[model samples]
Structures are given as structure tokens and as C-alpha cells.
Target chain A: MKQRFLKAAAIILWLLIWQILAMIINKELLLPSPYITIKTLISKMSESSFYIALLYSLFRIIIGFLIAVVFAFILGVISGLSKNAEILLSPLITVIRSTPVMSFIILAIIWFSYNLAPLAVNIIMCFPPIYDNVVKGITNTDRKLLDMAKVYDIRPLKIFKGIYLGSVKPFLAAGMNTALGLAFRVAVAAEVLANPKYGIGTKLLQAKYNLETAEVFAWTFMILLLSYLFEYIFKIIIESRRYNAQTRKSDKVI
Target chain B: MLRLENLTKSYNDNYIFKDFSMVIEKNRITCLLGKSGSGKTTLLNVLSSITDEFKVKYSDFEKLRYSYIFQEPRLLEWYTVYKNLQFVLDNTHMSKQAIHEKIMDSLKMVEMEKYADYYPYQLSGGMAQRVSIARAFVKDFDVLLMDEPFKGLDPTQKEDITDRFLKMWRENRKTVIYVTHDLDEALYMAYDIHVLGEHPTKILYTSRNAYKMNDTERENERDKIWQILRSQI
Candidate 1:
């Protein structure tokens, strides 16, 4: 309870600082006060476009993230198992890790329609971390346990389920958490550039272009809210999985 | 009989075992006693085919099923005690009910049937090792290789686990190769004890008690084995 109170207190303190700073600036056009942002946010809650924009953007980013997860996990398992695969995949993984998200956004815009540009950028941005973490997790599996498995003549699929997944799940969960956050950020930025017909990024761009600073702040607040909410939900899922894994009696199906 | 002829193993240009040969009696408990770094575990690994850089010609390698009880439990943390047993038994032709019954029997052997639902993390060290022992026994194998599986147990816990191990071994008399550095453990566990020394990794002494000895005789044998081990040190 004390910790909860302290967290709320800290957030209110920051909001108060923002309000004071806005009052001193006395320019609603440049830096909207917290009160104006909150008011605009409340009013926008009733707007049908707000839900449409959030839902569409949320679907695209989440679908892109899910697809990237599938691809990364498959590639990670292959790379982790075979030295030749790792050698072949290293250059591409390195390129994806090093290249800027903006460069991918531009390339995505050139290759895909406006609706797909953000999703493509999200997948590209999210793959490397998940893949790297999965490979690392599999690589770091306990050799002794593996030896035990071999001596017992455990089938390959059983070893993959009982041993490999036990080692990889935590790393995969951690990587997905980081990848999810990055995917959201890059997805929104891509949407702003692509100017899609229905998205939070589109609404954000419109508010900025019209110099509605309060609406921009409200939209920014909405984005932050959505990002935090999604991450929290993802965290709960990971934590519950970890908890279930710890408590369950049977082998987890990988 | 399981004969490991002219076994040679080296790692990173360091020869841990060179030209080592031993005829391990079938369906008998054989303990490899040595100090730390005396290639005891390396020899076990070679026997189990876990180390690939060794040449060990076995007498009946094709007809053997090998199970290992590692120094650590090595139980899958995600699996409960019963499931760890189930994992090794997956390739067997047993029906699900038969496998479950076998798992329960093994757990009962190790006195861990009550912990069937407990995951590895929930187990105490000795309890986890007992689960590992159960896992080894639950599998259908002709030989069981152990690498100091009882290394970290307290004396009482060690005695309890050793008693259970012996009881289980009595029921299923597979060729057992147990590796350990502890003298008392060697004396307690093996009918045949082979003492190894380092400086080139060779067998220094081999004591075989083909017949069951009384406690006094065993004590005298322990003293003799102690003297042999001391001379090597």
C-alpha cells in the first residue's frame, strides 16, 4: 500500500511540475497546460475516431509483432542448433540490428502500401532482439542436463520440450518485452510518416499540423497510455507463464 | 561384462586419460575412487558416450541402454519429479498407464512418491538428488553411470540416500559405474573399488570383494584402501 501511494505521489509531483512550467510559459500554442491536455483527452474519449484510430493502429502493430515473434523463434532455433546456420544468418541479423529504423521506414513506404508500412517497419525493428535472445538462451542451456538427456537416450523432441524450452522461455519472454516496446515506438513513427487513413499516428500528425498543442499532448498522452497498458498486459502474461511453468507438473509443449 | 578397452581421452591438448582399460563386471556395483581432477568423471563421460573425443571399445555397446545420475540432479526445472521420470521414459514402448506405474514405483524406491507433484525448484538438494536417482532407475537401462550424485548431501542424508540406492540396485542389478572422490562413499557403495591417481591419470589400485564381508572385515578393507589411496597422494 505504501509503495502504491508513493508511486501515485511521484506521478502527481511530475504532473504538478509540468503544470507549473506551462503556467510560467503562458503560451497555450507552444506548451499546453496539463489541465488543457486532460480536458482534451476526456473530450476525445467520446469521439468515435479516437477508438477507430487506436483499434486500427493497435491491430497492425500487434499483428506485426506476433509475426516477427514467429519468424524470430524459428530462425533462432535453427541458428542455435547448427553452426552453419548461425554463420549464414549472422550477417543478416547484424544488418537488421545496426540499420536505423527510419531507413527501414522509408524502404517500407517504397515497397508497401500506407496501411502496411508501419507493420513492416515494426517487424523489421522487432526481429533482432527476439532472435538474439532466443539464440543466447538456447546456447546457454546447461550442458550437464543435456548430457543427462543424451545418456538417458531422450528423444530429440522430448529434449527440445523438456530441456530446451525450459532454458529458452525466460530469455524469449525478456526479449519480447523489449521488442514489444520498440515495436510500438517504431510502428507509431512509421504511421506518422506513412500518414495512414486510420491510426493514432495520423491523428497525432493532424493535431500537430493544425498547431493544436493541447490535442497533440492529449494524443501523445494516449499513445503513452496505450504503450504502457500493452506492456503491462504483456508483463502479466509473461509473469503468469513463468508462474505456471514453475508450478505445473507436466512437460511444457514448446 | 562391460569391457572398456584401451580408452583414450584428451581435451585441449591435455591428456586426462590415456590407454586406460578396465573390465567392468556386469550387474555389479563398481566405484571409481580418485582425488579431484583424476579423470574419474572424464572416464564416466567416455563410458556414457557424452565425450566424443575418446576411443572406448565396449564389449556389447550395441545392446546397452545407458542412464546417468550426474553430480547435480540436472532435473528439468520446468518438470515435476514425476515428469522428470516420464521424460526419460518417453521413447519406451510402455503405455501411459504402465509408464505412470513405473514412475510411481521408482519414486517409491527413492522414498519420494509424495513429492511427485513438486517441481525441481521446490525440492531440497537431497530430495532433488533422490528424484534424479528415481529418474535413473525408472528408465530401462543395462548400465547406470553416476558422477558423485551424492556429493552435496549431509552425512545422514548421504546414508539415507545410499541405503535407498543400494536397495534399488539390489532389485535391478545393472552394471553400475559410480565415480566419487570420497573414500567412505566408495567403501559404502561398491563391491569393487578402483582407485585412480592423477599425474597422467592411471588406475593405482583395484579392490574386489566378490563375497559379502562382515562389518569388521569391511572396516579392515577400508583401512587397506585408505592406505593405498594415501600412498598415491
Candidate 2:
């Protein structure tokens, strides 16, 4: 309770500073007050176009993220198991990690239609972290436990499920958490550049062109709120899964 | 008999065993009592085929199945005690009902039946070791390789676990190659004790405890084994 109150106070203090700065500037275009920005956000929420743009960006980004997860898992396992595969893919992963997100967005816009550019950018940006984490998790499985499995002549499927999956889960969770945040930021940036037909980024760019600074702030706040809410939901899901596993009761022996 | 004949192993030209030939009688508890770095674990690893670095001329032990109890409990942290046992048994051809019966029976034998639902991290060290013992016995194997499974416990806990292990072994007699550096552990558990020396490892002394001995005889045997181990240093 105390921590929550302190956090609320800190946020209020920052908003107060913003309000004072806006009053001193005395130009709405130069700096909008927090109240005006919030009012614009509320008005946007009443428009059907707002939901359309929000859903368009949300679906594209989330679908791209899920696709990246699948590809990363398959390639990560291959890289983990074979030295030749790791060597073969090392340079490509390195290039992807080193290149800027804006560069990918530009290339994606040139190579594909504007509708597909943001998704392409999201997938390209999210793959490396998830892949690296999966490989690390696989390589770090306990040697002793693996030796025990071998001695017992455990089936290959069982070892993969019980040992490999068990070790990889935490790493995968962390990787996805990081990639999910990056997904939203890169998706919006890509949309702004590509000028997608219905997206928050397109509306944001329009607001910028019209000198509607309060609307720009409102759109930016919406993206921030969506990103925070999605990440929070993901964390709650992972935590609940772990809690359920830990507290599961044994079945009665007949 | 299970024989390891003319077995040689070296790592980076540091020979752990050279032309080592040993015979293990069937259905007997043979303890390999050696100081650390004396290749006891290496020998077990060779027999289990965990390491393929050894060159063995001939061995008929490949037809047998094995269950190993390592120094640590090595229970899967994600699994409960029952599930750990179930994991091994699930690979066998046993019916699900039979597997459950076997798991419960083994857990009861180890006095860990009440902890069937507990995860490994939730158990005490002694309790975890007992669960490991249950996991080993629940598996179908022709031979049991125990590599100092009771090394780090307090004396009382060690004695108690050893007694429980012996009780289970009495009911189900399997060929067991027990490895340990502790003298009392060898005396208390082995039918045949092989005292080993390091640096191109080989057995220095072998004793058979087939007949029950009085305290004086046991003490003399302990001293003789202790002297042999001391000489290796």
C-alpha cells in the first residue's frame, strides 16, 4: 500500500511539473497541458476510427511476434544441438542484432507493401533475443541430470519434454517478455514510416502534420498504455502457471 | 559373473586405469573403496558406457540394464517424488496401475510415501537422497551402480539411510557395485571390498567379508585397510 501511494505521488509530481511548464509557455501548439492531452485522449476513445487503428496495429504486431516465436524455437533447437548449425547461422543472427530497427523498417517498406512492412519489421526485430535465450537455455541443462537420463535409458521424447523443456521455459519467458516490449515500439515506428492505411502511427503522423500536439501526446500515451498492459498481463500469466505447477496436488493412489 | 577385462582409460595422456581386469560375482555387493582421484567413478562410468574413452578388449556386461545412484540425489527439481519415479517407469512396458503400485511400494520402503507430492527442493537432503534411492529401485535393471550416494550426510543420517538401503536390498537382491572412500561404509556394506591406489590406478588390497566377524576381527580388518590406503598417500 505504501509503495503504491508513493508511486502515485511521484506520477502526480511529474504531471504537476508538466502543467506548470505548459502554463508558462502560453502556446497550446508549443506545449499542451496534461489535462488537455487527457481530454484529447478521451475524445479519441469515442471515435470508431480509434479502435480500428488500434486493432490494426495490435493484430499485426502480435501475429508477427507469435510467428517469430515459432521460428526461433525451431532454429534455436537446431543451433543448440549441432555445432555446424550454430556456425552456419551465427553471421545472420549477428547482422540482425547489429542492424538498426529503422533500417529494417525502410527496407521492409521498399521490399513489401506498406500493410506488411510493420509486421516484417516486428518479426525481424524480435527474433534474435528469443533465439539467443533458447539456445542458452538448451546448452545450460545440467550435465548430471542428463547423465542420469542416459543411464536409465529414457526415451528421447521424454528427455526433451521433461529435461530440455523444463530448462528452456524460464529463458523463453524472459526472452518473450523483452521481445514483446520491442514489438510495440518497432511496430509503431515502422507504421509511421510505411504510412499504413489504418494504424496508430498513421494517426500520430497526421496529428504531427496538423500541429495538434495534444493529439500527438494522446496517441503516444495510448501506445505506452497498451505496451504496459500487455506486458503486465504476460507476467501475470507466467506467474500463475508457475504457481499452479508448484502447488499441484498429487492424485490419490488406488 | 560380470567381467571388465583389460580395460584401459586415459585423459590427455594421464592414465586413470591401465589394463585393468576385474571380475564381479553375480548378485553380490562389491564395494570399490578408494581415495579420491583413484578412478573408482571412472571405472563405473566405463561399465555404464557413460564415457567411451576406455578401450576394453572384451566384456559380456553389455546385455545387462543399469540403474545408477549418483553422489547427489539428482531428482528433477520440476518433478514431485512420485513423478520422478513415474518418469523412469513410464518407459517400461508395465501397465499404469503396475507402475503406480511399484512407485508407492518403493516410496514406502524408503519411508518417503508421505512426500510423494513434494518437489525435490521442498525435501531435506536426507529425504531427497531417500527419494533418489526409491527412484533407482523402482527402475528395472540387472545391475545397480551406487557412486558414494551417502557421502555428505551427517553420520546418523548416513547410518539411517544405509540401513534403509540395506533393507530394500535384502528384499530385492541385484548386482551392486558400490563406490566409496569411507572405511566404515565399506566395512558395513560390502560383501567384497577392493581397496584401490591412485596414480595409474589399481587395486592394492581385496578382502572378503563372507563370514560374520567379532569386534576384534572387524577392528583388525579396518586397521589393515586403513594402512593400505595410508600407504598410497
Candidate 3:
């Protein structure tokens, strides 16, 4: 409770500083106060178009993220299992990691429809962290437990499920946490550049063109909120799974 | 008799075993008592076929299933005790119900039935080792290779777990190749004790310990085994 109160106070103090600065500037286009920003956000929330744009961006970004997760997992397992596969794929993964997100967005804009550009950008941006973490998890699985599995003549499928999956889960969760946030930021940036037909980024671009600084601030706030919400939900899901595993009751033998 | 004959194992040109042969009588407790680097664990690993880099010939050991209890508990940290046992027994063609009963029975033998739902991190070291022992017993194995499974426990806990292990062994009479550095452990558990020496490992002395021996005789035997182990150091 105390921590939450302190956090809220810190945010309020920052907002107060912004409000004072905006009042001193005395030009709405140059600087919108927090009050005007909030009012614009509330009005935008009441409009159906705002929801459609929000949903449009949300859906595409989530789908892109899910696709990246699958691809990363498959590639990670292959890389983990074979040195040759890891060697062959290392340069490609390195290039992806080193290249800027804007580069991918520009290339995607040229290759794909404006609607698909953000999705492509999201996938490209989100793949590396998840793939690296997955490979680390697989390679770092406890050797002793693996030897125990081998000695027992455990089936390959069982070993994969019980040992490998268990080892990979925490790494995957951490990767997904980072990737989900990056997905939102890059997807929105892509939408702005690609000019998607319906998206928060398109609305932000329109607001920017019209010099509606309050609306721009409102839309940026929405993006921040959405990113945090998704990250929190993901964290809850991973933690709840671990909690269930820890607390599950065994059957009582008579 | 199960014989491992003409075994040779090396790591980076340093041999641990060379032309080594030992006979393990079936359904009996045979303890390999040795110093730290005497290759006791390497021999156990070879017998269980956990290490394939060795040139070994086995006689009368076909169709044998081996269960290993490592020095550390080595329970899967992510799994509950029940699930750890289930992981091993699931492919044995036993019904789910049978597997459950076998797991519960083994856990009960180890006095760990109440902890079936607990993950390994939740258990004490002794409890986790007991659960590990339960895991080995729950599986279908003709031979049990123990590599100092009771090494790290407090003396009381070790004695208690050892008693429980012997009780379970008495019921099933599986062929057991027990490895330990402790002389008391060997004297208390083995039907036959072999003191092993290091450097291309070989047995220094073999003592057939009759189960009916009195405390004085057992102490005398322990003194003799200690002398052999001392000479190796």
C-alpha cells in the first residue's frame, strides 16, 4: 500500500511539473497541459473509431507476437539440439539483433501491404530475445537430472515434456515479457510509418498533422497503458502457472 | 552371477579402469568401499551403462533393467515427488492406477508419503534423498546401483534411511551394487565388501561379511577394511 501511494505521488508530481510548464508556455499547440490531455483521452475513449483503431493495432501486434514465439521456439530447439544448426543460424540471428527496428519497418513497407507492415515489423523485432533466451534455457538444463532421465530409460517424449519443457518455461516467460513490450512499441511505430488504414498510430499521425498536441499526448498515453496492461497480464499468467504447480494437491492414498 | 569382464575406461588418456573385472552375485548387496578417487562411481556408471565410452563385456546381464541413486538426491526440481516417480514408471506398461499405487507404496516405505505433493525444493536434503530412493524403488529394475546415496546425511538420518532402504531391499532382494567411502556404511549394509584402490582402479581386498556376525567381529572387519583404504591414501 505504501509503495503504491508513493508511486502515485511520483506520477502526480511529474504531471504537476508538466501542467506548470504548459501554463507558462501559454500555447496549446506548443504544450498541452495534463488536464487537456486527459480530457482529450476521455473524449477519444467515447468515440467508436478510437476503439476500432485500438483493436486494430492490438490484434495485429498480438498475432505477430504469437507467430514470433512459435518460430523462435522451433528455431531455438533446433539450435539447442545441433551445433551445426546453431552455427548456420548464428549470423542471421546476429544481423536481426543488430539491425534497427526502423530498417525492418521500411523494408516491410516496401514488401508487404501497409496493413501487414506493422505485423511483419512486430515479428522481426520480437524474435531475437525470445530465441536467445530459449536456447540458453535448453543448453543450461541440469546435466544431473538429464543423466537420471537417461538411466531410467525414460521415453524421449517424456524427457522432452518433463525435463526440457520445464527448463524452457521460465526462459520463455522472461523472453515473452520483453518481447511483448517491444512488440507494442515497434508495431505502433510501424503503423505510423506504414499509415495503416485503422490503428492508433494512424490516429496519432493524423493528430500530429492537425497540430492536435493534446490528442497526440492522449494516444501516446494509451499506448503506454496498453503495453503495461499486456505485460502485467502475461506476468500474472506465468506466475499463476507456477503457483498452481507448486500448490497442486496429490491424491491421498488409502 | 553378473560379470563385467575386461573393462577399460579412459578420460583424456588417463585410465580409470583397465582390464578390470568384477563378479556381482545377483540379488545380493555388494559394497565397493574406496577412497575419493578410486573409481567406485565410474564402475557403477559402467555397470548401469550410463557411460558408453568404456570397452566392457557383460556376462549373464542381458535383459537387466538398472536404477541409479546418485550421491546427490538429483530429484527433478520442477516436479513433485509423485511426478518424479511417475516420470520413470509411466512407460512400464503399468496402468495409471498401478503406477500410483507403486509410487505411494515406495514413498510410504521411505516415510515420505505425506510429501508426495511437495516439490524437491520444499523438502529437506534428507527428505529429498529419501524421495530419490523412493523414485528408484518405484521403477521396475533388476539391479540398483547406489553411488553413496547416504553420504551427506546426519548420522541419525543416514541410519534411519539406511534401515528403510534395507527393509525395502529385504522385500524385493534386487541385485544391488552399493558404492561408498564410509567403512561403517559398508559394514552395516553389505553382504560382501570390496576395498578398491586408485590409478587404473583395482580391488585391494574383498571380505565376505556373514550377516550373522556379532558386533566385535563386525568391528574387526571394519578395522581391516579401514587398513586397506588407508594403505591406498
Best by lDDT: 2
Order candidates by lDDT, high to low: 2, 3, 1
> Chain A of model 1, TM-score against the native?
0.94
Candidate 2 pairs with clashing backbones: none
lDDT for A68 (candidate 3):
97
Off by over 4 Å in 1: A245-254, B61-63
List of chain A TM-scores, every candidate: 0.94, 0.94, 0.94
Q: Provide the interface RMSD of candidate 1 in angstroms, 1 decimal place.
A: 7.0
Better of 1 and 3 by TM-score: 3
lDDT scores of the candidates, listed in order:
0.86, 0.89, 0.88
In model 3, pairs of residues that clash are none
lDDT (Cα, tens digit) per residue for candidate 2, span B1-233: 88878888999889988888888878889999999999999988888878777888888667679999999999888778899998887545778788889999999999999989887777888889999999999988999999999987898999999999999998878899999999898899988888888678888888886327678888999999999999888
For candidate 2, what is the lDDT?
Answer: 0.89
* Model 1 lDDT, residue A58, Cα: 92
Report per-candidate DockQ.
0.55, 0.44, 0.52
TM-scores for all predictions: 0.94, 0.96, 0.96
lDDT, candidate 3, A141-235, per-residue tens: 88888888888988898998899889999999999889999999999999999999999899999999999999999999999999999999998
Return the top candidate by DockQ: 1
Residue A14, model 2: lDDT of 99
